[model samples]
Target: MAAYGRGAGVAGREDLPVLLVAVLLAAAACSIAQAQQQPVYTSIYDVISNRSDLSTMKRLVDGLGLANQLTSGTFTAFLPDNNAWAQAFTAAGVTEAQMLTTYRDPATTLVNFHLVSRFTTIVNGSIYNNALKISDLAVNSTRSYDTEAGRADSDYGLALTRAGNDTDGAGGVQVMGRSGPPALIAANQSDIAAGLSYCNVISAVARFWFDTYFDIITKSSVTASSASFAGLVAAGGQQQWLKDTTLTGTLFAPDNAAIAKVQADLKLNFSTALSQQDAADLVRYHMTDVPFNRSAPVNPVATKLKDATLTWNGGQFLSVAGTLGRPSNNVRWVGFPRSASVVPLLDAALLPLPSTAWKLVVAKSAAAGASASSGFSSFIKAMEAQMVVRYQMDDTSKVVTVYAPTDAAFARLESYTGKPFASLASAIKDQIVSMHVTQGAAYTPSGLLTATPLDTMAGSRTLNVTRASNSAAGVQLSGGQTPRGAAAIVASDNVMYGRSIVHTLDQVLIPAGVVLPQGGGGAAGVASAPSGWALLLLVALAVCVQRWALAAA
Candidate 1:
């Protein structure tokens, strides 16, 4: 089949000859008399068969035994010339002598493609003046026609566009097909630009109906391995909306390797029943609302799925990174010839995290705390320097509850140390930071209020939790060193960073054996001396324990 057009509007072809003479005589009389005084015709078959240019279509209709049906119905047909027929014959590898015998049914289907079950007239000054007319792309005059491809619904159809002075100052008309740019409408041998009418039927010279572009679901089923699409289809991702051919769009299908990774990582086995919600959400993320062909404009395009969008990372070696390729409308379904959906064989399955979480960590974190002295910007910076937090960011399963120390808290830690936080050894700093996080569990502030002495990810150390009367002072977490005088929880229950739950603390909690000020008492100064041999041993122990714990994490 020839490539379907997508540019401007166009039409197609079929046959009738003995019917041509009568149509011409009627046309000649109308021209001689007033154009409005034309005789009322019996049906569309009369106009189509009488057109000398539509002889090939006439023969196809006759062979299909649909001549009588055409005469009795009200319909519109985009008839193509004999040139179009000759071209189709050449493409099918059949000569004109074998046209009736070799390509009978195929010719009939082609003719049926041109005949839409509605009466649409595109003449000057009519309701369709400079308007785009459309019809159901079917095999017959009604909804009951059936074929191997299934029944034709409103979702899968054809369109016609009329470009008047609005397009180019000079009026023009074009035909857009289902695939490539629409070709200019070829005039009939009679040189008539306007469509011919008989009774409730109208006929116009147009392009062929070559349904080459596959729908989104069909394209995915073909290009992607059974492992990927089969799971998707089972998950109900291939619903009627995806199967609609009338609306052109794109699909980002993952290959077998990607699907395998998802299965392994998510612990999903396609052998069992699919998780419909998860699979459907993932599939929706891969679909876009625009038809990004090679010629499509480069930009961030929105997807049908809410809050998800796609954009090209131009010049990015996506294949090297394991993605199919850069975002280009030019991408076709892998191993398929000219497909409808742009199937970029993704190296990995796309998993959409909660949008709110992504916005907090990646977007709002910086500006949100910029003006606050007791905000988490300093803790954010410190966490960025650690390799463990970075690893956790990429690991979807590791949920971490972080006790964020504000800028003022870091400054207080500096005052106690008599130096900047960075002046301390990296190992010591890592211990202090590790002491603030509770790994493998995300607790709400209410949960923490009743749970005291929680284990820290720094290996053996534990932190105390306390509940108070005032809302601001309701929940508190204290380091093992200082129980009564410790970091006051300023903000609580914030779970915006994926699996990471954040609770902003007003002060930095000191790890075990970290020295307190000279005037401090109680658990604040467990050691007899600051910088004594005992303090040295505790610091060394904290470092080793933290190193082991980080490795384990």
Candidate 2:
């Protein structure tokens, strides 16, 4: 019986080709049947009508009278599902009847933000090959399609970024609308089974749609024009510059009132002719490399203005600085666009830095640290001897966060090491000083509350960030080669040099060594807190650290 079974298996193997052909034929017939039954959408109306989830969107399309036009056009429609509509209704604080009647045009415009007139079907088969494709909304020519929201026509209008075989070498691919972060097609609602597939293009319902983009120039001109920044157009020739669609940037526009006050403080007349240097300084101080959404608070971002850079964290709530005359002093967000935002500052323009962070530090070190009143002489001498300050100041890419110790901190280090700081080898001095710096990342006092395991410029070493018992201590950041104690970030965000953020530490951070100073491994050094001017000396040391990183870069 076993021999007969083996022979039968062999015969089946020999007839495998015929069996495969039969299976293929069956599959072909099934595909033909499925194709015959496939629902054809003559218009977007048919597509929306087929899905119960898209009922709200269908009402919008019908209300706009775009059913006939959409049916014959090739386009990609990002229809919001029923859940999205419910959320939108709740957010807008309106009932469905009121939305259709009182808010019809506004509702139509909101719906139009989702529609892109193009054949933007995601080729599912090609996605496995890791292709990255982006669609820059091409058909946005007139108010009929995309109504101009802010000052100019949309520059970053509804971009569709598709990644087939994600370039990051990650296994899965994603499709993103330039509204926010990209959503995974396979992971999200790739539920096209219920969709009205057409020959021209297919529409898949999106989890969410992108926000409407507004140009910075347009937002500034309309919202900040009256009281906020009337002279921004006149003083800096910003009217012509911003209107040019080719350039994109973040403009921190001071209100005309604020500008006038600043001018009075400087004793300069706005109406009179000014030097090219002064006008450039006034304009550049308000400019940042990246565009920020004034409507929302932002994470701590670096500004291009270097010395008088606009640096603030999401927690700072800068919008709260100029809005009303109440206790909160909030700044008003006068514009709605994401690409270009207009924020009103009631007080003054950001002043330009006299020199780079490195130069400022070098001066401070010489003036304060080397002086009899300041105790940072030993630390300054060692740094100057090594020329570490030069290296740190030269690098532009790195934003060195220095936890500089006062002269007293160095005195304690000298007492522990059984040698003067200046006597140590150049290599040892470099390692010791480098241990005090956390490279690349910049954290404000508020940002430090959550950041931890901060990597130092010293390779492989790390530090922990924690809040002080008294909020006045700002934040304590500490770590080393060994388990020596924490240093209090006494004065935080007090210094900005080029891109370097300087924080003054109450005690010097010593990496692991045999000579641990008394109370160095513990929080016993808090008594030697730096005065306000002493804190400036600590910032000077950061310039030295920046120079080192720059040389390496």
Candidate 3:
């Protein structure tokens, strides 16, 4: 009898509400597992095979050479088809160089801002909001997840539309936007309306797109000849040499203009004075070593040429400490031939560099050549002890906003005459970095909406808003009447589209002295960064639950 009772009790316990709870938990777990399945299409062809946008899809695919990668697995491509390319095509007057060199693209930003770590089905609304996801990363391409507000603003199906690459008829070209249309009419309209208002911004930030995070051969169409400073003159076995060098060996193969510059500068015959070895060093000076697409080493130590007289523009791009700026043209790597390559016979002339003696054999001695400061410098002195952002991989996806000041801006700092760099505190004593410290990427705009706030490394900024000659709110940056403030935003939203951002500011800002800009990093005083542990934990818990459930079953 005792045995029977015990057995009965155990059985009852197993069948009680506890059993119901376990079953429900199992179902919920399964749902989550399904959610994690992610979207997978073996190849782009697979998607095209079933979709009606055949011809359109093919053109874009060929342009990007995405098919090869698609064959391996599924990908959530930020598809910007011909139409997308075209819209920019008309507005595209913003030269690829400008786009690559300046401005920001919300869509492109999302593509890079978020990661493809695991397959993420980024339906539009999956990422959107005024609230930025990676707070540490001061990018405007933030994700706002508020469904109601987004839907109210017609945010729902937005992500879904992007996934579908939806389109509308307004645009003569086919593309998609938050509203879901095959036409780029919306983007265009926005560009048109906000364009002039933020033309500088778009041009600068979009340069991010042009900026390479990986090694690339920045090329454009050119006859097998010399035409510009950035033009190539490789031929025969030399062409092989061009192909042999790593991407870091930027071939400043002079365009006619650049070649002309070199001739004028050195009194040399472009045809004979410059040898292939000399060409190599010219290319070397044009390139500061990077892992292919890696962003310019941050606050890279002050560079000095051991040999030649080539100089880097000594100014921080219109960028903050934690961003990639656009003043990168000063350097280029040689190996890569296509990705960000821009080739053209300069309409004018080009220049050349000395190789054997100027490059490898000697330490870089050029005061102006490739010095980290010349790449981009926003303040009088950015870092008290210049530094470098250590990187292990090519990072063409990174972009920084550089706040470049003209030669005069620095000269205005009186103390620069000869006194040691001023400390970051005293307005007149020492304040090298304190001068160029605006937070967040300030896309250069010739000018923009009167209200747009300009963030500086200062973390918070004071905009002296203005409205033409009418409103008092107009900006007054760098000693000018800016619609924004003390920060004139000479060029607003200089979008560094793909991987880099470079903006040329008229004058540098002052960081109120030693007030390190927001999120300063390095051996410097910047504090430890925020942790990604929460994110890791979240992912782990999600994974563990599935494993446990599978094992139990």
lDDT of each: 0.52, 0.49, 0.32
> Could you report the Cα RMSD, in angstroms, for every candidate shown?
19.3, 25.8, 35.8
Off by over 4 Å in 3: 1-226, 229-381, 384-396, 415-420, 423-442, 446-451, 461-475, 478-501, 512-553
- Candidate 2 Cα errors over 4 Å, as ranges: 1-17, 30-38, 119-156, 163-553
User: Which candidate gets the maximum TM-score versus the true structure?
Assistant: 1
lDDT of 3 by residue, 1-553 (tens): 9999999999998788988999999999998897676333344445443434244444444444444543443322223343444454354344433333342232223223111111224566594212111112222222222221122122211121222222222322222222212232233221111111110001111111222312123232232243333333341123443443233222323345435543443223434444455554444433333332334434432211123322222332221112212232423212112232332223222222212111110111122334432323223233423322111001233333334443344433322223223433354322333223333333333332443445433334343333343322233343222112244333222221212233334444543323332222212222222368977998999999999999999
Cα lDDT tens digits, model 1, 161-214, are 444422211223343333334433443211122333212112232222233333
Question: How many clashing pairs per prediction, in order?
Answer: 26, 28, 182
Instruction: Output the lDDT of residue 266, model 3.
Output: 28
Candidate 2: give its CA RMSD in angstroms.
Answer: 25.8
What's the true lDDT of residue 384 in model 2?
61
Show the lowest summed lDDT stretch of 10 residues, model 3.
195-204
Alpha-carbon TM-score of each model against the true structure: 0.44, 0.32, 0.26
